[model samples]
Target: MKIGELSHLTGVSVRSLRHYEKKGLIASVRLPNGYRDYSPLTTETVDTIKLYLNLGLTTEQIAAFLTCVLKNKEAFCAEVLPVYRKKLADIEHQLKQLDQIKTNLIDRINSLQQEEQVKNE
Candidate 1:
């Protein structure tokens, strides 16, 4: 199939498909007429790419383990484990930072409110 067909089947934009190709996350062959031709299996690859993106993994990270997953038909390949662990750790760190910010904001609000109450008396 052509790039357009792949995009339609995958519900991904043509530009994004091109970007994925450029990132080495996906590939296509050029036809004699110069149009890009993608295999039917590319749809599955695109879906996998989208799934990883939704999990907050960058294309670069996905590329590192995608081939293992696709070729072996196992999402939990050895190469993927470290990447998953790192991403989870990163998310946990962000959550801790956000919690600190929330606590600070609440403390500031309470202090301001107390000052306002004193001024009213």
Candidate 2:
């Protein structure tokens, strides 16, 4: 299929599909007329790419995962476990930071409410 068809089937925008090709996350062959031709398997590959992206994996990380899945494993390669763990740890750290920010915001809201009550009294 062509790029447009791939985009339509995958629910990903044409622009993003092109970006994926450029980033080496996906592959396409150029026809004589300079149009991109994608294999049917590219759809499944796109799904994997999107799943990794939604999980907070970067393009470089996704590229590594893609390499493993394309192999005989049929999924992310077990060899990449350490890399995935590192990314998971990074996300956990960010979650902790966000939790702290949330607590601070709640505290500020409570303090403002107390001030408002004092002013009205």
Q: Using Cα atoms with residue i matched to residue i, what is each candidate's TM-score against the true structure?
A: 0.92, 0.87
Q: Which parts of model 1 are misplaced by more than 4 Å?
A: none
Which residue runs does candidate 2 get wrong by more than 4 Å? 74-78
Tell me how far the alpha carbon of residue 24 in candidate 1 is from the true structure, in angstroms, after superposition: 0.9
Clashing pairs in 1: none
Q: lDDT of model 1 at residue 86?
A: 97
lDDT leader: 1
lDDT of 1 by residue, 33-93 (tens): 9999999899999999999999999999999989988988655588888888999999999
Provide the lowest-lDDT 10-residue window in model 2. Answer: 71-80
RMSD of each: 1.4, 1.8
Prediction-by-prediction clash tally: 0, 0
Q: lDDT score of model 2?
A: 0.87
Candidate 1 lDDT score at position 14: 99
